[model samples]
Target: MNKISKRPRTTLEQKIMILNHHHKSQNSQAETVNHFKTKYSISTSSFSEWLKDEQNLRSLYNNSNEFLRNSKRKLNFKYDKINKEMDKIVQSALQENQVINEPMLRQHWCKLVSIYGVQDPKRISSFSHGWLTQFKKRNGISKNKKPIELVENDYDLFDSN
Candidate 1:
């Protein structure tokens, strides 16, 4: 029996590099596929599959440009920093015995969004109620109030019949 070896998977970066080179060369899609098949031993079906994903293709194209990629990385970093700051604020509020009811939570998030919105309009555009809910869930912030338990000492005081 003959055993067939599986081809190595292509990394996203490699795919991007190949696509960028193909685009710069201004070759037809078929020609590009043929070139990669001959050079890298990748299958035509694989190229077709990769190109079929419109969103991924667009992202790869955008990332191929250094300026666009750097801007995207910076924007992502800003969003991450905003999220971290918001988490700290929420944690501090919880530590201070503040209840995380919908109104209170929404108000807090609105203030944060407004504060950060001045620096980046895109940040404000991405804020939504759903994001708040996801944040709360991620931080383990619960909506239901937990009942306080009485200690044995407190029970003894109440037993003075």
Candidate 2:
């Protein structure tokens, strides 16, 4: 009896690379399949699936930054509609160059989730710290450099010579 090997999980970067090479490679189809099979341990069927899913991969890559590119798993937003609304609010704030810290994000998220749970009084949901981190990555939100406050009046209190 032969034991079956587990299929290798492809990262987002790996998927994009494979798709790009598939389009640009001068080699024949079989050769391209062989190359991916050898390097990524991905089967021909999986490669075909990636080719079909090229657009989605491209969209994911375009929306994400370098920090999130190499991740092996893609996180799907559980509360899709709620998340979209929250994302819009966050995006507007970011476009205005406003500083959105963790607390502010949490407050918004909590309020959004609460609003969604209105029909079911007992239904409750809250975003986790991990979710917040991933949310920032998904939306390309980052901390701006801290600005120092300037004093209005200087050297007035010091009278010693």
Candidate 3:
């Protein structure tokens, strides 16, 4: 009797990664299948099985998009945290009548990443002038002024005026 070999099981994450790679590449479907088969040691029959599972393919697509969205969210959160910290530092300096410039801001960011042990210091340090400008615009923060603050009894002050 001939022995039948069992195919290796793959995780959803691995499947998603493969599908994303295939989606992003300029290769045709057949080329992608062949590439994945050779690279991952998967058989063409197994690839066919994967293709036949509509639900699995849909899940893979959704999961891939979700992965990208989550990555973007994490990066945005990092940027927001950096922006808030920078605002605090700049506000403190302004109180002391010191002007904070872009170079100073970049230095403060480097110091913050070093002190706080950010996961990817390079990401934090890779901010270009255009990126910094967009970040400031998005956060509505101005280097020349303190961030706007809402205070209690502001309506009373307006009434008095």
Candidate 4:
């Protein structure tokens, strides 16, 4: 004859502490669940269900370590929004300039980057080049802006005008 054994229930605080500890230790959820089951003599599936039921645990599991339960700190940087604003700036510069030539685009791109305080020269060059390439493709404009005869067959696309 087999006897059913009663397992002691883990408190919410204990579960949260276990979750937090495993999270800080950079263990995967599966690993954490397995470790807890072994250490506490509990069932992994039940623990997983409890984590989903608790709002804080749900948030913690979904958001990783960036979330703080008590603090209202904003984690996003203004620079992360640079691309959208820069695209607008580029579009406006193209409209104002009346022609989306490489030199003009580069100038406006650099100016926008300066305004945005993105000071790296290499990054400025890269962003300008990439955006210009996409802009050219989107607008269906040829990089060959000069008179066909005067244009060199292989003029470097991003070379200063």
Candidate 5:
């Protein structure tokens, strides 16, 4: 049987230090993972998790700063104008008996993806979901619908016109 080493949980700060040290030493992520596993007596999985946590924290910190900047730039919202526009759209959709379905959204999204020449379905799904959620939130619309499965054929054989 192999040895089961007890790896201690290292702090986020320590993980950052290890990452910076490896970066300064011109080491790749794989090399750093291996090096940390041996030098710090930590498991490879733990090191990988630490790296992911560090990257996520960095992204969140950057996004927070961006949001702050965006908030400062919004001087004229024109709430009434936005409400009128949304009301018009809602009335039009209701008159046409048009309901927004996942397949329709997926089809529309696939057209845009094809126009942009993007082949990654995950990227398309994430972008579509983000836009839909943001639009719903802005219009004060309820988004309690079930999650939709985006199939490979949804993009491959879809034509939105």
Candidate 6:
């Protein structure tokens, strides 16, 4: 008996790449699938599903940043509008040399979510540090950027004392 290696979950970038090749290729589905299997390790079932959702997948890729290619799951757009508002606020805060941290972002997100109301009802009132990380990445906001944090010791953690 041979041990079968589990296939890795494909990111949006990989899916778009594979789909583009598959569509542009002169080869048949089986042939294209074979090529993907050898190169990307994507299974036929996943290919079939991706093909079915081609329109959505392509749209998502178009909306996403190629350089910041998303993780296994696509970006959940429930907070998209909120994200724009937050982007403006972050930019202004950065201009004014405000400290950007997880708690501050969470509190701001809460206020925005309440004021704007949520697009997705299932969306929670609070966001996690992971969500904040993704939000920063998507907006090209760097944590290491000195302008965003004026004081070395000025942070939510240190302020609590």
In terms of lDDT, which candidate is strongest?
A: 6
Alpha carbon lDDT of each predicted model? 0.55, 0.66, 0.55, 0.53, 0.49, 0.69
Candidate 3, which ten residues in sequence have the lowest lDDT sum? 152-161
Superposition-based RMSD of candidate 1 using all C-alpha atoms, in angstroms: 15.2
TM-score order of candidates, best first?
2, 6, 1, 3, 4, 5
Off by over 4 Å in 3: 1-76, 124-126, 138-161
Which model is ahead, 1 or 4, in terms of TM-score? 1
Distance from true position, residue 103, model 1, in Å?
2.1
What's the residue-level lDDT of 73 in candidate 4?
28
lDDT of 1 by residue, 44-153 (tens): 67666666764665675554333333222222333565677766766676676654454444445556777766456554544565666556554566545442221212
In candidate 5, stretches whose alpha carbon ends up further than 4 angstroms from where it belongs are: 1-95, 119-121, 125-128, 143-161
Number of clashing pairs per prediction, in order: 0, 0, 0, 0, 0, 0
Pairs that collide in candidate 1 are: none
**Cα lDDT tens digits for candidate 6, 1-161:** 99987667778888888888887886766787888675566777878888999998887678656544656776566567888787777777767766776666666777788888665553446675566666777766665677664232344631321
TM-score of each: 0.35, 0.65, 0.34, 0.31, 0.28, 0.61
Higher-TM-score candidate of 2 and 6: 2
Model 4 misplaced regions, further than 4 Å: 1-97, 125-128, 143-161
lDDT score of model 6? 0.69
For residues 27-119, what per-residue lDDT tens digits would candidate 5 score against the true structure? 776778777765455566765665677676445335433332233122233233433443455445445645544454455555455555665
Model 4 CA lDDT for position 99: 42
Top candidate, metric TM-score: 2
Error of 6 at 117 (Å): 4.8
Q: RMSD of candidate 5 to the true fold?
A: 15.3
Error of 3 at 63 (Å): 36
